[model samples]
Target: MKKLVLTGAAGRLGSYLREPLTKMCDELVSTDRVDDIGTLYPGESYVQADLSSLDAMLEVIKGADMVVHFGAIGDEAPWDDILQSNIIGAYNVWEAAYRCGVKRVVYASSVHAVGMHLKTDTIGLDAPHRPDTYYGLAKCFCEDLASLYWDKRGVESVCMRIFSCAQATNARSIGTWLSYDDLIHLVERSIDSPVVGFTVVYGISNNDRAVVDNSKAGHLGYRPKDNAEVFAKAVFADTPPLDNKDLANLCIGGPFATVELGNSGVAALGVVDDRKET
Candidate 1:
């Protein structure tokens, strides 16, 4: 690709993706609301932009072959905050992509979009939306928005409903983990795939205890290599017995399914800040 744009460049996941994305395209434009994202990769440039502004999004996404949109609040928040950063932000991204004539959008969706479902039931790409929080509702909105753009404006999109992208620190992560290596692979597949009009795929690793199916997205060729089972012994040993009645323990969304309407769910997961430095 001649040019690729990545949003949320200052985030932990974005930090890891920056260097690798620079290698995929001649020019990788990374954007975030922050002033700076430390150092830049060899073929990369940084742009400070807010996702809520359509003009700013257009400027960052213009002249791009594809957009890897990972920008958002990343957690449950007040309705107003979610409205601006997630719901409206998603509209801006897709609208800007449509206007810019970008070929595809690789969105970072989340499992919380269907978090209210039972963990025991192995769901697939066709599962209905059962958002667990305002944050999750944002993901559901984006997935539908991606679909709308594809059908109405010919703007392709791949919405990856990512599970736990952090370390397998708890029992829930044992079945929901998506390692860093696997994440890069998924993004690569979404970008390189030749003919994805609008697709949804579960962002999970090759674990023995995975709770979601990705057979529908086989065309993307996303084959995760890492497994959370490796951390099973330690996590199980350190953790207490599970409560079958607890929504957090029984639901696919884990802490998110049980969190208050606008409260943060990630705080209970104990994800460490391990952003890769440039």
Candidate 2:
């Protein structure tokens, strides 16, 4: 592809993706709300743009072959904030991508979309949306929007239901951790895979305790190479016994499944910062 656009370039996950994405195309346009994203890779350009502004999104994504849409409120929050930054933001991104003649959109959907489902159930790619918060609801909307766009406008999409793309820092992460390498693998597969009209894949590593199944999305050829089992012993030792009555302990969304609508679930997850330095 000659051009690739990535929204949320200043975010933690986006930061890790920039360098590799830069290498994938002739020009990689990275956009975010910040004035700049510190530094740019060799074939990379930064454009400060708001996700909620359709015009801004369209301007940044014009003439792109694909869009990697990781931009959004990363946690549960007030309804108004989530509405603008996540819900409206996603619509603008998809609309802009479609207008720009972009072939595909790789969205960063979350496990919270099905957070209310029990972890023991081992939900599949076809699992119904049961959002645990306003943030999760936004993800469900994105997936549905993707489906609509694919069916009507011939745009391809991959709604990756990311499950804790952080270091295995807790008992929940032992089952949910998605290593940085695995994340890059997932994104690359989402981009490179042919004939992916509209797909949903679980963005999890090859963990022994994985709660989501991606077998249905095997056509994408995503094979995760990392696992969280190495940290399982330490995680279990540091964590307390799971509360049977706690929504976080019983559900796939973990803390997100338990937080109030107007609150944040991030504070509850003890994440060790493994963000890329580059």
Candidate 3:
């Protein structure tokens, strides 16, 4: 690719992608609302823009071969905030990509889209959307948006239902943790795949106790190498026993399924690094 655009370049996940994406193209246009992203990689550049503004997003992503749309509020919040950042923001990205003639869009979807389901069921990409919160609902909307764009507009998309891309700090991480290396691998496979019209793959590592089934999305060639089992003992050592009555412990969505709407579900489960660390 000659040019690639990456949204949410200032985000922690984005931090891991910057250098790699910069190498994938001649120019990597990294955009965020921040004035700057501290330091830029060799072929990377930053643009301060909001996702809710279609015009601004179009300007930043236009003339790019593909877009990695990692931009969005990554946690549960008020419906008003989720509407602007994730819902409207998704439309803007897809519409902008369409107008810009970008070939593919890589989205940062979440496991919360199917969070209400039982973890023991081994749900697949074909599983119905059972969003636990407004945040997860936004992910479902975007996944559907991608499908619509593919059927009507010929724009391809890969909605990665990322489980958890942080360190294995808890028992749940044993099954859901996706290392930074695996995250990069997943994204690379999503980008390099030959045919992915509207693919939906779970973003997880090869954990011994994983609950998700990515068999249908194997065409993407995302063969995870890392295993969360390496941290199983360490995590289980300090983690408390699972409570059958607690939605946070029993359901796949964890605390997200237990939290009240318009509240911070992510806060209820202090798992990932919330700070925008680079």
Instruction: Pick the lDDT winner.
Output: 1
Backbone clashes for every candidate come to 0, 0, 0
Between candidates 2 and 3, the one scoring higher on lDDT is 2
lDDT (Cα, tens digit) per residue for candidate 2, span 1-278: 99999988888999999999987899999999988788689999999999999999989999999999999899999999999999899999889988889999999999989999999999998889999999899899999999999999989999999999987889999899999999999999999997799999999999999998889999999999888999999879988888899888999999888787879998899776666665
Model 3 lDDT per residue over 1-278, tens place: 99999998888898889888888899999998888888787888888999999999889988999999999898899999999999999999999999999999999999999999988898988899999999999999999999999999999999999988877888888888888899999999999898899999999999999988999998999999999999988879887777888878877887898999988876765666653444
Of the two candidates 1 and 3, the one with more favorable TM-score, higher being better, is 1
Backbone clash total for model 1 is 0
**Model 1, 56: alpha-carbon shift in Å?**
0.5
TM-score of each predicted structure versus truth? 0.99, 0.98, 0.97
lDDT of each: 0.94, 0.91, 0.90
What is the full ranking by TM-score, best candidate first?
1, 2, 3
Model 1, range 198-219, lDDT digits (tens) per residue?
A: 9999999999999988898999
Give the Cα-based TM-score of candidate 1 against the true structure.
Answer: 0.99
Candidate 2 worst ten-residue window by lDDT:
269-278
Which pairs in model 2 have colliding backbones?
none
